[model samples]
Structures are given as C-alpha cells and as structure tokens.
Target chain A: MALPDQITFASSPALSRNVVDALRAMIASGAVGEGEHLKESELADALGVSRGPIREAFQQLENEGFIELRRHRGAFVTTLRRRDIEEVYSLRIALEQLAMERAATRITPAILARMNEVLDAMQHVSPDAPASEAVALDLDFHDLVYEAADHDRLMRSWRYIRSQVSFFLQVRNRSHPDFVSVGYAEHRQIRDVLVAGDPGRRPTRSSTTSGDALPAPRRSRERPGLIAASGRRDPA
Target chain B: MALPDQITFASSPALSRNVVDALRAMIASGAVGEGEHLKESELADALGVSRGPIREAFQQLENEGFIELRRHRGAFVTTLRRRDIEEVYSLRIALEQLAMERAATRITPAILARMNEVLDAMQHVSPDAPASEAVALDLDFHDLVYEAADHDRLMRSWRYIRSQVSFFLQVRNRSHPDFVSVGYAEHRQIRDVLVAGDPGRRPTRSSTTSGDALPAPRRSRERPGLIAASGRRDPA
Candidate 1:
C-alpha cells in the first residue's frame, strides 16, 4: 500500500525521527498489531538502523501513547480501551469546533479552493477505496483547518490524536461504506461555514457528535463495541 | 514537595508508569534542565534501577512530548519555542472553554464548594508566601475545573499542556507581581457563569474574519527570546 504523502521524510534534525515515522506508520497501518511487542533488535535489523535509533524511536513513540514499554519485558503497541477511543473523539470534537471557528475567518480563498479540490476528488473515489486513503483525505481537510487556526501546539496534539484514531478507522472502514459520503458532507459544511465567516453560529444540528456522524448501527455490527469503548467512566 | 494525591499508584501491572511519573516530576520541578541529554545508564544509576526500566520510562516521556531522543545523542528535554507557548495557550483557551461548557452541566455543588475552599486558601496565603505554594493553589483551582468536566482524556491533555506552560511561567512569574487576586477573580467569574449555565448565547462573532482579542500586556517585559525565535508568523 502506498503511504500517505504527509508521512514523507521530515527534515527532523534528529535521525531517530525517521525511525519513529517508519514505526508509527507500521503500527497505524496495522502491520504491527495492537499489543504486539516491539523488539529493539528486530526493528533495528529490519530498518537497517542501529539499536540507538530504534531505542530513541521507541522513546518517542511511547510518549505519543502509540506504544507502552514494560520495565523488563520490552515495548508493545498500545491497546486503546473503548473509553479511550470515546475520550479521544470527544476531545477531537472540541478542538475541531475551535479550529472551525478560527478557520472561518482565516481561511483564505486559496485554502478554500484547495479544500474544494479535495472534496471533488473524494466524491469520485469509490467508497471502497482503501481505508487509509479515505483517512488521509480526512486528515488533509482537518490539517487545513488547524493551519488556519495558526496554532502549532494544537496542530501537534491533533496529529498525535489523529494517528491513534486512524487505527480505529482502519478497523471500522472494513465494514462501513457510507462514512465516506457522510464525512465528505461534514467537511463540505464545515468548509461552507468557514467561507461564510460565521464564527458565533453553531453548525446546523445535522452534524453528528462523532466527527463523522455515522448512521445508526445495522445488523448487530461493530458499532456498539467501538462507541461504547471509546470514552472514560466515572471512578465511582 | 508533596506530590498531588489524585494519582494512585498500583504496583502490580506497570513499573514503567512508575518510572514515567518519577521522571516527569524531575522534569517538571526543573531538576532536569532543557536540552540536557538523558542517558539511560545514568538515569538508571540515579534511580537505583537497570537500563531496562529507565529505557521504558524514556519511551513514556517521549510520547508525552516531554523529551526528544536523537539516534546516538540520547534524549533531551523538549524545548518550547515562542510559538510553542502561544500555540499552547491558544489550545488551552479552546480546551478550557469546552471544559467550562461541559462543566456547566456536570458541575456539582460539592465540586464548586471544593473550588471555593481552594480559592479561600489562596486568599489567606499572601502572594508573597512562597511562589511554589501560590502555584500549587493555582493548579488546584484548574484541576477542580477538569474534575468537574469529568473527562479523563481532556484532563490528561490539560495536564500535559499545563506542565509545558509551567516552564514558561517560571520565567514570567519572576517579573510580574503575583496576580493571584486577578487570577482568582477570573476563576470566580468562570465559575459563576458555569453555575448560572449561561449558554454564552452571544452568537459566535464572525469566526472567519475576526482577529484575536489581545489582552493588554500585564507586564512590559519583552517576550523571551526562546519563544520569539520560534514564533510562527500567524497567517491571520
């Protein structure tokens, strides 16, 4: 599978970043399964890098919550409990709403034009297109909003969360077809709202709480297990 | 220094987490300076552990964005650029505003009362009474708000950002008189609004075109060079 352009080599001053990106993609793409142990020697050999870079990359990945390192056992890809997923999406809604509010005014005509181009491209792509492609498009659209907000820190946080959520999307996309259209529509509406420069107004109620606003479950599918497990419970 | 009581440590499942917490405290308290390389062997030696747990802790810290690891150079505390601080605060406003909105419904009298108790504690302690104490109270108030919002993911993100901001606050606080009263008043107003459940009904102003509301500079000190160099030219 072709990797998304966004994951291309960043001129990060640190070499370990290159390793981090490689490993992150592997994990996000499900090549590295959830809870799979990450062995330094194996990864180092596979990537043709030294144990130093592998260890450094592991350090970076662990911080991003992509992996968990056990003291003596070693590192493993992180498993998100259902509540963890909900909490992530909920936070995404809050940040995206804020970005949309800021992007409304700041989105230049050029940015809007690019967004429209993405929408048009998405329209023609079959809903059956690889889930990664769909997820990449979704990210590109949101990245534009984040860029417009002019907040680097927010963008970084969003990037981290998006990486985690993309894992879940990979699973969900295998079964769901209509999310592409619904997601595209939400993007279009959000774009329209920004272009119109309406900051104070909430988007029409049709926008679902989930970023995608997927339709209700059909045929006892993956819906309940995923959504129920997405957020946190009260300690009580 | 007394660690906050909110975090309960369980010894059974995750030793890496314990190491992560210990290292985080070290970084947060300024025991580890920015740009200082973290050597696995050295840290292990200091903590009376092996390289395994230290390496595990490094992974956790890296994911949290607290440190950056270079291939052969080892790990160093992540440095914030001026833009990084601005982005952090901007995101804080967005996240905090959402928390405030959610807290409007979830906030209980008991939480409000606890917040008031903390505020009262601040009132009794003069601003001159140790910077650490004042900062503790400040954190307590914000923590209460996060608790009221009842979102664990948001709280975790908030805590991460707050820790980063604290580094800058250390520099800023030295120049400004402790504006404890003003800070408390703002919290009070926010609490009052939440208690009243005022929907903040003012139509969001045209989000697209409006510029940020720049607060009058409370301190005339020049922006830190560290941040100024890193600040992105905002497209807006």
Candidate 2:
C-alpha cells in the first residue's frame, strides 16, 4: 500500500521517521491487525532496522494513539472498538462543522478548485482499486476544507483524529466499494455550497440532534452516511 | 510551584512521567519563558536525571505542543503569539459549547455538586494565591464539564490544546488576579444553566456571530472574556 509522505512526527529531529511512517502505513493498510503484539526484534528484522529505531517508532506511534505499549509486555496495535469509532465520529462531526462554518467565508477560489481536483481524483479510482486509495482521497477532500478554514489549531484538532478517521474510512470502504462514487456526489454538494459562499445560510448545524448517532446495524454503512448526507451544510 | 500529577506522556510504561510533569509545570508556571532554549544537559543536571529521560520528555512535550524540537538544534519553549491565543480560544469556545450542550441533560447531581465544590474552592482562593493555583482550579473546573459531557475523544481534543490553554490562563490570571472571583460568578451562571437542564433552550449558540472574535485591545483581557461571558449557555 502507498503511504502518505506527510504522516510525520512533531519531533523529527535526528530520529528515523521512516520507521514511524512505515509502521503507520502498515497498520492503516490492515497489514497488521488490531490488538496484535508488535515484537521489537521481529519488526527490526522485518523492516531491516535496529531495535533502537523500532523502539523510537513505537514511542512515536504510542504518542499518536496508533499503538499501546503495555508495561512488561511489548507494544500492541490499538483496537478501535465500536465505542471508539463512535467517539471519533462524534468529535469529527463537531470539528468539521466548525471548519465548514469558518471556511464558508474564508474559502478561496483556489481551494475550491483544488477540492474539485480531489473529487476528480476519486472519480478515476476503479472498482478494484485499493480501499486505501479511496480512504486517502476521502481524507484529502476533507483536508482541503480544513485548509480553507485556515484555522491552525482547528486543523491540528482534525489531525488529532485523522488517523482514527482513516480507520473508520477503511471500514466504510470495505463495506461499500461503491461509496467512492457516492462520495463524489456528496462532496459535490458540499463544494457547491462552498462555491455559493453563504456563511449565514451555510448548513453547519444538523437539523436532527441524532446527527452524531450511529445506526445499530451496519455500523460502517450508516455512520459516515449521516455526516456525508445531512451533517454538512446541505443547500437543498 | 505545585504541578498536577495527571500531566503524563502516552508512552509512560517505562519512562519517568515525573520529568514530563516537571517540565510541563515549569513551562506552565512561566519558570521557563517562551522561545527559551532548553539545554538537555542543564535540565538533566537541574532535575537530577540523566539525559535520556530529558530527551524522552522532550519528545513527549513536543507531541503535546509545549515545545518545538528543531532539527540540528535543541528544544525551545513554544511562544503563544496573539494569533495562537485567538486560535486556541476560538477552538476552545466551540469545544466547550458542544460539551455544555451535551452536558446539560447528562450532567448528574453528583457532577453538579462537584462543580459547585470547585466553584466554592475558587471563591476561597486568596488574592495572593499562587497564579498556578488559580490555573489548576480553572482547568479543573472545565475538566469536570468535559467529564460530564462523557465523550472520550472530545476530552482528548481538549487535552490536545490544554497546555496552551494553561499558558493562556496563566496570562489571564496575571492580568486579572481578581478574575478568580469574576470567574466564580461566571461559572456559577453556567452551573445554574446546567441545573436548568433544558437542552432545547440551552444557550449553546452565541447570540452574536462574533462569539469567536477577540477584542483587539487588551487581548489577554477580552479574548477569554468572550468565552467566559457570552460563549457558553448564558440563559439571561
């Protein structure tokens, strides 16, 4: 699976961030399952690095909530249970709502054009394309909104959950491969609203309080569907 | 200055969290000024630890946005510019608004009583109390609201900016030592609204769209003043 070049640690001084990104990409691509113990020696042998960098990478991953290092035991991949996903979704909704509200007026024409390009990229992904591809594009699309919003701390808050959000998107992509195309239409609606540039009329608030609610069944299918459907400023 | 024992690193399984807490307290208490270079050897010498723990603490501190680790250079304390303060305040206002709205119905009598206790404690804080004392109580007060909200990721998001928020509060306390009393009244108002417990009528939305705006003059005075006064559920 292709990894994002920008997935970096804040403390990049004199450390091998490559190990960090490689492990993150491995986890994000489902190469390693959740709750699996990552042996330092084994990972060092596998990744062709020494134990020191592996340990450092583990520390970085733990910092990013990607892994848990148990005392006396080795590092274990974090399992995002249903409750964790719900927490991530609810928080993401609040953050994106704020981002969209702020971006409504601040969004530049250039950013809108860039968002159109991301949608176009999604359109090019074939049905057999890797789910990670769709996931990356999906994140890229929202990343643009945060960029346009131009609030640094707001962007940081989004990044704080971006990893979990990526996992959630992976679940969604596996559940619905056709979601990419559907997402195209959903994002188009949001883009049109951004193009309209109506801060007062922006549909930042969800009409129903259940906006954060996830359906009991088909967890992946219905959870993001709410945000993709009614959570944004739907001009309709 | 007394530090909160809860300030910890995610990778605390082996490393000494005392170093992280000590450094954070030093930073938050303004013992270490902004943009000041932190020599690892000196810190290790002063804190009576080896350089290894100090390095580990630097990585953790950088992750929490307390300091910046420059490549080829050492660590430096993060300077919260006016822009950074505005960003922190605006994002915080949004997060707290969401927390209070959700906390309205979910807040238990036990929690309200606890909040009342916090306020009572605030009322007793003498004028000459250490600035960090007020800072800790101020954070403790908001920490309860997040707990009442019962959203894990939301609380994590709060913790993300918490250090800067600490710096911001320290700035406020120094500027207005009497803010503890003023804050008592303000929090009492919010507590009354929570006691009212009407989500339908909760004043979650700002009456004026300028809820996030910081008054240009006397930023330390007016920026938090907005959130402390008009940003929450102000029923009156």
True contacts kept of 2: 0.69
lDDT of 1 by residue, B1-236 (tens): 22232334566656566778788888767677666678777766566667876776776676566887555666887765555555665677667766776677889999999989987887777867656566677677778878998886688678767766555555455555545555566556666766887536332322210111112233455665543343223323
* Model number with the top DockQ: 2
Show model 2 residue runs off by greater than 4 Å: A1-15, A71-74, A205-236, B1-15, B200-236
Give Cα distance to truth, residue B66, candidate 1, Å.
8.1
**All candidates' lDDT scores?**
0.66, 0.70
**How would the docking of model 1 be graded?**
acceptable
> Per-residue CA lDDT of candidate 1, range A45-134, in tens?
676667887877776686567887666777887765655665676677777766766677778888888888888877777867777788
Q: After superposition, how far is residue B213 of candidate 1 from its true place, in Å?
A: 14
Q: What is candidate 1's CA lDDT for residue B71? A: 57
**Candidate number with greatest lDDT:** 2
Residue A23 lDDT, candidate 2, scale 0-100: 91
